[model samples]
Target: MSKPISMSRRKWAAAWAVLCAAGLALTAALDASSARDQQPEKSVSAECDKYIADIETQLAKAKQEGTEDGVVALAGVHAGPENDDCSDAFRDRFGGDE
Candidate 1:
């Protein structure tokens, strides 16, 4: 037969169990909070379309001006380090300089 658990031992065991359950709940809550925070941007196509339109407008204005600055302007946008929503589509339509 097993030895009977003392009163103090039973109380300690119950406290330990409560602490473990609380820790697990805290971990799960933090995980869910992070997942919610990291939700992806929606309507990617709409954002990309607007970006492309702006780029094309700039390109058209440059073309109409008929100046050397037109080439510089186009090159500046093409060679930009930052990539926006339309970057891939723009790259596919017009080859990347690098």
Candidate 2:
């Protein structure tokens, strides 16, 4: 007859299986996150487009009103990190005129 597994060996086997499953799960999650990070900058959301449009409208109004201060303030906002994608979208839409 085949020898039965001892208690210690059974415990070791269960622990090894658990570790392997955990490792696989962690690897899959990391891969998915990296895949999202690799997406192109041009894949901005609708919200980003709307934000850029709002900035454009405000800038046009500032220019029309001859408010240099308003234009400078808006420029700072447009240069912020959160607006990077929106600004890229705006530039692409406007044929890089800005």
C-alpha-based local distance difference test score of model 1: 0.66
RMSD of each: 12.9, 12.2
Which candidate leads in lDDT? Answer: 2
Please identify model 2 stretches exceeding 4 Å from their true place: 1-7, 41-98
lDDT of 2 at 32: 94
The residue pairs found clashing in candidate 2 are none
For every model shown, what is its TM-score relative to the native structure?
0.40, 0.35
Which of the numbered candidates is closest to the native, going by highest TM-score? 1
> For model 1, how does the per-residue alpha-carbon lDDT over 1-98 read when each residue is reduced to its tens digit?
99996678889999999999999999999999999999475333665566667767776777788742554233333333344545666666556642
Per-residue C-alpha lDDT of model 2 across residues 1-98, encoded as one tens digit per residue:
99996678889999999999999999999999999989575687677766667777877888888873553333334467877777677667655534
lDDT, candidate 1, residue 21? 100
Candidate 2 Cα deviation (angstroms), residue 67? 63
